[model samples]
Target: MHDPRVLLDPATDAVRKLARRGYDLDLDALEKLFSRRTATVSATDDARAESNRAAKEVGAAAKRGEDVTAARERARELKARIGELEEQQRALAAELDEFLIGIPNLPSDELPDGSTDDDARLVDTWGEPPAFDFEPADHVDLGERMGILDLARGTKLSGPRFAVLRGAGARLERGLAQYLLETHTERHGYTEFSVPAIVNRPTMTGTGQLPKFEADLFRTGVADRELFLIPTAEVPITNLHAGETLRAEDLPFAYTGHTQCFRSEAGSYGKDTRGLIRQHQFAKVELVRFCLPEQAAEELEVLRGHAETVLRELELAYRVVTLAAGDTGFSARYTYDLEVWLPGQGRYREISSVSDFGTFQARRAGIRTKAKDGTKGFANTLNGSGLPIGRTLVAILEQHQRADGSVRVPEALVPYVRFERINPDGTTS
Candidate 1:
């Protein structure tokens, strides 16, 4: 959330900055609202002082044995006026908070000025797409042929945009998640955690998933309480220290978690309707970090590398792209998406996204840090999918698929999978 004071500062160019992220600021109305809020606050303060003065006069009159009724009546009137002003101030503050929270984070000045994924700037490419002699099959066809993926049964049980992995497919998904968690914890220095999949409304809002993106969430009621299934482990992991102030020595905190994520895909109708590319329930290894504001830029790059390591270990070809201003996520000031090559689709698809929230989420979640000088400020928060298990599995299946329909397991995952290859006959060799 942006500081409301930014809107009041003409030098900050807050309105123009927010416009770059596709947010239209009603400056005229916002100015008027701020003015009214200011005026109401001043009036409330004055009324409070006047009430106190009037009460003091009544007390002095009573002590002097003089007529105190008139002074008491004046005090009562002043108290009532103060109450009214206080109510108005509360309403104004609420309105201001609503407006501020609805606004998306300001885009970084370095972002390219454009509106879609096409505008994303390519940062780097790793490895090369494998050459295939025979016509390659998409994961949907390969998994179904191997009796691993059951999309038809999934639809019958839940509806469209759902899938079930059986046999090697299920094991592969589990292996990928375990491999990611182990790599992040052991090699990347991330503390591993197991988090809940259901979170309350405040927890969702802390990670910028609530209030604005509620439509993309799966909500349920437990008795009289409303809860939401986490759209990503990022939600739970990032909120772990919400509303806490850490010491300056703990400027940087790293955490990783693996969990099942749920998303409604509300506005995304008829898009990627097949396979594991998009699903209602998917598994992912999430990465989250909390650091001082000054360290955010470097932290984001390091975080991206951690995610890219998964692709490298799996020997997958991939590219990194920095999202354009308009394409960045709501809470992120800047983002880099890792798109892995899927030979089956003959194109690159997003497998993970690393983002620097730059105090935007910290402000909302009340996460702060205290400096040695005793000064306090909001901490910068960052998170990314170390890799979504489904998409990583998708890449592995399509990239390593043999002409005979067998798939070679990546050496890194061989220990966890205990298989060299998944044969066409659904047997491991």
Candidate 2:
């Protein structure tokens, strides 16, 4: 959420910035809402003041031994008027809040202009795509042949877009999650957390996942309490400090968590349906940070590098791209998508997205920072998929597979999975 005053101020370029993201800011509508709220507030205050004055007049009239009937009647009328105005004030404030919450964050001015993924600006490319001596099999073929992935059974149990990893595939998924968590916590200086897979409404909204993207989420209920399956660990981990203020000395908080994420895949009916590329449930390790607003840009770079470290360690070929305004996430001012090369798909697929929300989430979540002088302001929030287990596993299988159908595990993962290769017979050796 944004400060309505700043967004409504004519002198600010909030509207123009929002336009870059394809969000048409209805300033007139917003301004009118703000005006109505302000007027209601002012009227409420005036009525309360009159009520107080009338009460005082009644007291004085009683002390002077006067009838005091008129004074009491005046007080009663004022009190009723104050109640009416206060109700209007509450309604208008809620109306204005809903309006502000619906607005997307303004895109960074330095972003490359575009409206789609094709217009994304390529920032860097890593190792070259591996050359194959034979036709490469996609993860679906490789996993099915090895009896590791069972999508047919997954659909039987749940529905389409669900997956069941067995044997080596399941082990690899666990190993990747451990590797990611250990790397981020031990080497990247992040505090590891075990967050809940189910969260409440405010927790989801704190990270900009509710109200706007509810259709893309899975919902549940416990008795009368409504709950949501977290789309990403970012939601629960980043909101760990929601509605709290931290000391300036602790200006930056890096949190890493592994969770089984769930998403409804609402609008994506037919895309990436063949494999784990798009799934209803997947394992992911998420990285979240909270820092002073001025530190956001630099922190974003550091966060992006941290995500890249996973690909580097896994020896996967990948590229970093600055997403166009139109392609950026709802709460992010700037984003860098790390796309890993997949030989099977013959293209790079987005494996992770590191985003800098620049206090957009902080304001909404009520995450604040307090300086030494006792000044307080919103803290900037940022997060990235340190690595998604499913996609990373897919890349590993496709990139390291031999013509004989055996898959070589990345050297780094050998220690965790206890083997260097997944044999064609579904045995690790």
Candidate 3:
């Protein structure tokens, strides 16, 4: 959420910074709202002062043995006025809050100025897309032939865009998630957490997923409370410290979680409906970080490197791209998308996104940290998919498929899978 003062003061640098985000600022509307809010506040203050003065007058009149009826009547009138003003004040405050929460975070000045994914700038590439001896098969063809992925049955049970992993496919998915969690916890210094998949409205709102993107969420009614299936582990893991204050020593808190993410995919109708590329339910290993304000920029790079390490360890080819200002997520000031090379599709697809939210989420979440000098401020928050298991599995099957229909397990996941390769006959070799 932006500081309300920035929207009110057009001449401030913060306002200018917001202008660079390529959105038309309705300064006149904002000013009108600001004026109404200020007027109510001023009226409330005046009423409060008048009520106080009237009470004193009643007391003085009684002490002087004068008739206090008129003073008491005036006091009652002032009290009623104050009550009405207070009600107006509350309504105006709610209106301002709604306006503030709807505004997206200002894009970082370093971000590219375009408005679409095509405008994103490529920052780095690792490894090369594997050369195939024969025409590579997409994950759907490979999984169906191996009796692993059952899209037909998935559609029977649920509907389109749902999938079921059988036998080796299921194990492979689990193994990949285990590898990612272990790598993040044991090597990357992130504390692993198993959080609840169902969260409340405030929890979702804390991460900027509610109110704005409600259509993309799976919401349910649990007794009297409304709950939502987490779209990402970032939602719960990041909100672990919501409405709390941490010490300066805990400036940089890192956490990792593996969870089943459920998305409604409301806006996407006919895109990537085949295979695991776009699914209603998917598994993801999420990484979240909270740090001091000045450390956010550097922390984002470190977080991105951690995600990149996963692809490097698996020997998967991928590229890092800086998302353009308009393409960035609502809560992110800047984002880096890691697109893995898929031989089956003959192109790259996004497997992970690392973002630095720069206190935008912390402010919404009421998460704060106390400084060494006793001053308190909102902490900067960041999160990334260390890797999503479904896409990683898609990459593995396509990249490691042999001419004989066997899939070679990456060296990093061999121990977890207890085998080096999965044969078409459902046997491990």
1-429, model 3: which lDDT tens digit per residue? 777776566564555556666666666777778789999999899889888988998898899999999889989988898888889889998887888887888788889878787999999999989998888899999999998899999999999989999989999999999999999999999999999999999999999998899999999977899999999999999999999998867778999999999999999988898899999999999999999989998999999999999999998999999998878998998999999999888999999999999989999999999978998989999999999999999999999899988899999999888889989866777
Q: Is candidate 1 or candidate 2 better by TM-score?
A: 2
Q: List per-prediction Cα lDDT, in the order shown.
A: 0.91, 0.92, 0.90
Better of 1 and 3 by TM-score: 1
What tens digits encode model 2's per-residue C-alpha lDDT throughout 1-429? 999899877777998999998999999998899999899888888888888888888898899899998888888888888889888888888988898899999899878888888989999999999999899999999999999999999999999999999999999999999999999999999999998999999999888997999999999989999999999999999888999988978878999999999999999998999989999999999999989988988999999999998899898999999999888889999999999999989999999999999989989999988999999899999999989999999999998999999999998998889999999978989
* Alpha-carbon RMSD to native, per candidate: 1.2, 1.1, 1.6
lDDT of 1 by residue, 308-424 (tens): 888999999999999999889999999999999998889999999999999999899989899999999999999999989999999999999999999999999999888889999
- In model 1, what lDDT does residue 330 have? 93
Clashing pairs in 2: none
Cα displacement (angstroms), candidate 1, residue 37, comes to: 1.2
Q: What is the TM-score of each candidate against the true structure?
A: 0.97, 0.98, 0.96
Worst 10 residues of 3 by lDDT: 10-19
Best by lDDT: 2
Q: Which run of 10 residues does model 1 get worst, by summed lDDT?
A: 1-10
